[model samples]
Target: MQVMDPLTSPKIGGNHLFCYALLFILIASHVSLSASARELKVEPKGSVKDLVQSSKATKIKRTVNGLLEVVLVDAKGLKDTERFSGGMDPYVMIKYKTQERNSPVAKGAGSKPVWNKRFSFRVQYPDYAGGNGYKLILKLMDKDSFTADDFIGETVIYVEDLLVLGAEKGKYQMLPTKYRVVGSNKKYNGEIRVGLSFTPIR
Candidate 1:
């Protein structure tokens, strides 16, 4: 058996320690980047092409009903200049406007949707003006006990009558809508997609 002296053993050098630290940082950075890439869950179910807007009516031809989930991300990787003094229980608010006979019956019928911990909402289309056409504006709210902040991202949904469509070919068609967002937080970025199930009226 070979014996080695404890005091004479080669002491670890600072350079060696530094090299170890560098390696550790590199590995840690790689791991962190990989984790972030997988952290955000964003998915698009079905094709947006399936959504078409009607020319005759100001509403989309298809009936939409189901779950909607969104993720908040850093669009520009900007930092928050102002601290958000808002509560953590964020919610989704759906505001609708129904138009029939070139008249607006419902201006803003708002609903506070049931939200999951991840800030997701399951929204239902309401019956408006005898099942006629309706236009919707959806917004998010950061809620406390009695206060709310309007979310950065806002979208519009045009809900049409179920029984009859306004397509030229007398066939069903989809609609087009847009969403826009602006915020003070440089890091605050968001994207959303909805999972829906459609039922035709008999």
Candidate 2:
């Protein structure tokens, strides 16, 4: 019987190859798992950051509930819609949220009209009725007896900041200011002077 040299034996060489293959497989599997763990950790952090940014972008500012008073002082440079009638009967239809009021007609006032009217509205911030509740819409119209009312021009007032400040200070007032009025033709047809006040309810 001849004794085989273990170092040069075929079986020993085969065993070495098998050990190297096993070690290579183990290292590759470990590297793959580490990369997967890193991805799992990094993805959530990015997602969380995106979620935070989105939340901030869509955040709604704080608002208050209160009574809002609007004063329609006057309007000037209005378009005379009743060219055939010689003079225009201009009046303003004021809207706040779901509330609506109409100013007394300035019959035959023509291009310039004076209302000096005060209107009141119950306001709740972030109105549930849809649309901007803090906005006041003033639609100027020429009232005609024989036909439909003519749309002269319109103006808008934003009172959200006023309401918020009023909530903080119990009341807020905006002195009469002139806002440009736009007509149905999308031109600056006139200007309207208006004042606003907000009183927050406790």
Candidate 3:
């Protein structure tokens, strides 16, 4: 067989080279796509759960130490606890944490009594080690000369939210609001009006 000139011959090897290059390109494209898919994959749901739990574990619990000022405004429709009297000698016994205060008697003020007195207490958020202390108890009483002091009614004021707000803002105030007074019989005997303020220490 006669040999053909190298340049004049048909480029038979070109098709094979092109086929090889096409195969190589397809393989490289597949590899690049697979890598991109892996990079775009979302983390497992379990990992997301663990991240949320970690966030909660790192969250800080708020604590505060401050001064609390209370204003004893007045009471209305109190259960006249006196047996036979012109008007019951009404007074208030205020209790907060372990501290106690007594208001001067609203002598003969009867069903509606007004004290408008101010009292202060040294206070702490999480007042006890177990942490549930922001409560104020007001016990209405009738002074008696011969018998035991009468328990007219009582009202409880929860100051946890107010204290927390004060701690956040450095101070907070609550205008006089009425709270229902409950008697030993567990009935709403009257309503007591009071105001509160808290100031946090640096």
Model 3: per-residue Cα lDDT over 1-202, one tens digit each? 9886544557647776677679989999999999999889676665424643553455426666788999999999998887576679889999887789999999989989999999998787645643336689899999988889899999999887676666665888889999999999999999999999999877
Residue-wise C-alpha lDDT for candidate 1, range 1-202, written one tens digit per residue: 9786433446756676677779989999999999999998886663433333333345444554433322222122112222454223334455433321111111122221222222233334444443324544444444444554445444445544322332223334332212333343533344323222223332
> Looking at model 2, which ten-residue stretch has the lowest summed lDDT?
43-52
lDDT of 2: 0.82
**Which residue pairs collide in model 3, if any?**
none
Q: Output the lDDT of residue 12, model 2.
A: 75
lDDT of 2 by residue, 6-90 (tens): 5566767777877877998999999999999888844355443354355345543665678999999999999788777699999
Q: What's the TM for model 2?
A: 0.67
Sorting all predicted structures by TM-score, with the top scorer first, yields 3, 2, 1
The Cα RMSD in angstroms, rounded to one decimal, for candidate 1 relative to the true structure is: 21.6
TM-score each candidate.
0.31, 0.67, 0.67
Candidate 1 regions exceeding 4 Å error are 1-87, 98-133, 146-151, 159-189
Model 2 per-residue lDDT at 138: 92
